[model samples]
Target: MGLSPVLWQFLVHWLHASALFPAEASGIAPYVDALYFFLVAMTIFGTTFVAILLLVFSVRYRREKNPVATQIEGSTLLEATWTIIPLAIFLVTFVWGALLYFRIYDPPTNAMNIYIVGKQWMWKAEHPGGQHEINALHVPTGKPIQLTMISQDVFHSFSIPDFRIKREVIPGRYSTVWFEATQVGTYHLFCTQYCGTQHSGMIGEVTVMTPGDYKKWLEQSNSGQSLAQNGERLFASMGCNSCHNGTAAARGPSLAGVYGSKLTLTDGRQILVDDAYLRNAILNPSEHVTAGFAPIMPTYQGQISEDGLIDLVEFIKNMQSNYRVQQTLVTATSGEAAPTTPSEGTTETVKP
Candidate 1:
């Protein structure tokens, strides 16, 4: 085949398999692109104007030829004019940009929440229903999806070029980004931050599908098989059950009912036991010790790895709702091992 024929065939294949523009993927893309263009135009205009003025003045007022030129005093009016003009321009840009920004930040009330954990060289995603994907994110077209992101290791960025949305996933904190995909296709996911040696290798894909197709995918993804489930298995494999068992007076507090509860510190300070806290407690046990609990928990710091933390957190959160079920079993079947109640006289104490 001729070169033109091969090129045409390639173009045809891409067109049939891909959705290119904002209209094809999501309605929000065009607005984001427009804002980007506006900023670019303003920067270009300002730079060009300054460059031209410098060139013109240099040639017209050459030092040798204009040695006797009149030295005019600065005018307050000219200074005021320049300052006011630039201020007005900035105000206008600020207002426009703010409007667009709020729109992006304010997610739809009905949007589904997906948890994203960014690690060294991969993106780990999980839906509320326990559907998990590695290095790939799937969302339903025409429905807004909010991603709650956090870094498992170092800082990383979750960016979708087609949606023109990106957010930094910082360690020890949660960051969120949301977008509604208008079309159904695969879009690129990149880590814009230079995380480590494998930063460039951190890439993924966002697959958008129709509502019906999304439901089907969700069902398949959650068919009793997922990373979240595997994480539970891994937790068991690591002997985490020994300390976290509900019925035992184990070294550490029971993992049951620990998530989303207010944990009182030794100094009478209260901290919410959210996902981030749970993860940190696992990776860096020395960071925050429970009020009455001894600092005997081993630091899984580098040994457990990033993926291990995600699995551990998922396992802990999953046990939250089912904790009561296990509590009853513990009391009835394992009365001797199970504590009848929480530690008595467990008043908060300050660390010296």
Candidate 2:
């Protein structure tokens, strides 16, 4: 077989690759580029202005031209002008970066989630559909995708250069980052944090595919059960369904619609039901007990592994979506006010 001209060119570039910037494959890349360019332009302007000022002053106020030097006090207007101008510029950039950070951090309610476990030297990814990969992630383009990541041993960082998103993977805690891939291609994924002896080798690739192709891939790579399905089975085996199934007599609060909503704690503090909160609630139930619910649920601290905890979290996340859809349909059919009762028949303590 003969290699095509395009393939030969790609191979040549790969062999002679330099430190070139990766392509902007994510929706947030443009915003990141904007901030980067802003900094570069400011640096150039400040350097050029200072250099020109020095040159002009040296020539105009030369000792050969004028023997005497005139000393003038600084102008308050000039000082204020310089201070306020720099402060305003800093404020503008600060606000712009803050907005972008929030947009990247706050995953959409409907984003497809993938769990990631960062070990000492490798990245393990698990799709909600049960497909698993080592050091590689396959996601569909043009859709919001959230990664709930945790480290097994030391702290690690999940970095995708092309996506402009990086998050710390802390042990015993969950951190999340999200992005919508705008381009369909393969991009580099790396652990930017210094882990251990194999830190340099902790690298991977992120493959973004089209919607149709991604669906096909999922169907083909079916693991005989989805993550949520496995979670449901684990829930039953762990005796979680007895309380979380939304029964009136259950001890624990109903989990339906509780994934992202805020719940009033027993101490009257409202907290969002995110990954970290859920993980804590599972491993430490007495710490942040929900209002009107007794702290009777047993902790699953040493009993469950990190991967198992993630599976349970994924199951709860799916329940939230299902609950919302069911509520919407019920409201449409009844033509009355939305029911206060939870669809799962449980008197869960969640407020909306």
Candidate 3:
């Protein structure tokens, strides 16, 4: 049967233009939805056109009306018209998709950075101010938020359908996704990948607040130490300063101003130091050993948490010749984090 008005309505309704329409919370959502609708419209048009031609040919070539079958010559012009039109349409679609992809993946230089770690059955979010949340992420509206995520266990997908953003969080690697919230409301966050038995329960909420409210929340939710501070503490506690001290006696490469610097590996490969490179160097040191140093740095594969690794990365990125490690009581015991109180004990400072 030919596609009727009822079929057209069904196609449109099934795509969730009504109750199931996703909220356009981020700046990229409207454009994403527009592209999706254009694709759906094209699909519907192609189906309708094919159905009409089928019905037309069936009625016109009926045996009762023409007794004998006749062969028709193929028209080069008709063939060329169909081929070139579909080719042009496909090229346009590809260009549109590629542009949107770049827009979604490239974060602005000043975007707010937030670190996310996913493990079996739960998600942990850490802010630069040291604020930590188990299942909820709070961000300010009208500001670009960039999330650097990693999976502590199996692979997981961090998804926020309202923002039209999703990225796969892989173990031993970092994944980044950014979005600028345009609305002040709460949206759903989910792990779209199945990890274990409790995968379904690995869900959370993302709260988008006004800039002022977000500032107030940040002030109130202070974790007593900034991420950089924690990184500084961890830096000394882990004895990282012994090798990365930037001194003549140091055995390993100095990390001062090395975050974005180009360095050559022992194997004659050159690489630019970035977040991923830092992470890999920390967890898998032998892979990117510096040209003049031995690969004696032990891998911190299971010794450090993802959040702590992020802290170390931040510290290294901002490290200068004058930077020093701020040793607190927490550095005394690397096994656990000591309580931060009104009376912060004596701190020891060591230069890089």
Candidate 4:
């Protein structure tokens, strides 16, 4: 049977106004509920006590009867009671909040990692398998998922109302958040940080699916091809190997094992060789010119689309472990001009 009219109306109102709506429940829901209840109790107790005391005092010390109120000495018992009660309440809150904080920060060992990049007004997410989504995130239900996020431009925030998680996506630094969905549905994603003029419009969705459905969706998302394979093809087609190959006396630095390693510049400076650095080396090589390297590397700023850069980065990352180019052999055999002496510059420059 359906709910009574009054009950239905109440339910509708509660769903509209309450944060306890079923769809909004996620990992942090229980702790959030606890805090909400605690605050409500505190509010009730404070208002009631203050109101009763005011009424009693007003009656007992009315100005018409006696304008000068009697000075009451403070009681040790009153001080002890207030101090002990608040200390006990604070201890309870601290324990509860600490447990939830640990749960939120420590992700499951088996959690699948996804990379998310926040730009001016959009979110670009990529699964390890190379499945990419813009302004949308997809994860299988009942499986833990971790998002490693960074912002390409100004500061942004990755927030999911349903999950009760909000994290800032800072530039040049990484932040992570994790969640395991209990239900299969689409949830809203919002940039809670005021990034720029378009911050309000930076919205997206998170789609949770059953395991079986997730597999099917993954297949569809990948279209039966691997991202690395696609990326390799793109790399070769774009003539990246001409300069980045091991054997080439190409004007550009060799990209072999460049991912996930430390790159030392011609100057004394060193920087981590990561996806962001690789992308920057491709799109804006002049930003951090290698110590011995000339600023001859051309920028691919508009030549490649955002997705193309992601593919390229993925390809380079995959090559991190298995890249086996013989630099000396390529330089010696290639008909392209080779450097004659150690003093001669050997870096190759590619025209965008």
What TM-score would each prediction reach against the true structure? 0.66, 0.81, 0.86, 0.64
In order, what lDDT does every prediction score? 0.75, 0.83, 0.84, 0.74
Cα lDDT of model 1 by residue, 134-181, tens digit: 999999988889887888789999999778788899986777889988
Candidate 4 overall lDDT versus native: 0.74
Each prediction's number of clashing residue pairs:
4, 1, 0, 11
Each prediction's RMSD to truth: 8.8, 9.6, 6.3, 8.1
Q: Compared with the true structure, what per-residue lDDT tens digits does model 4 show for residues 1-352?
A: 2347787557645864785563544656555655655666666777888899999978988998887877879989999998998788789878877887888888887988788989999998988787889999988877888887878789999998777788899875667888888777899999999989999999998998889998988888984435565666576668676555554456556666778778777677899986668778888887888766678777888787555676787778777542333323334554435434322433534422
Candidate 3, residues 260-300: lDDT per residue as tens digits?
A: 88999889999999889998899999888888877788999
Q: Which run of 10 residues does model 3 get worst, by summed lDDT? A: 342-351
- lDDT of candidate 1 at residue 75, scale 0 to 100: 93
Candidate with the greatest TM-score versus the true structure: 3
Clash pairs, candidate 3, are: none
Q: How far off is residue 305 in model 4, in Å? A: 8.9
What would the per-residue lDDT of candidate 2 be over residues 1-352, giving only the tens digit for each residue?
1456787457545633654656778999878876876776677778988899999999999999989988888899999999998899899989988998889889998988889999989999998888989999999999999998999899999999889999999999988999999998999899999999999999998999999999999899888767776776577679786566565556667788898799999899999998889889999999999999778788998898888888888778777544435445545864657544434545554432
Better of 2 and 3 by TM-score: 3
Which 10-residue window of candidate 2 scores lowest in summed lDDT?
A: 343-352
Model 1 residue 197 CA deviation (Å) reads 8.7
Give candidate 2 misplaced runs (Cα > 4 Å).
Answer: 1-19, 242-245, 320-352
Please give the lDDT score at residue 214 for candidate 3: 94
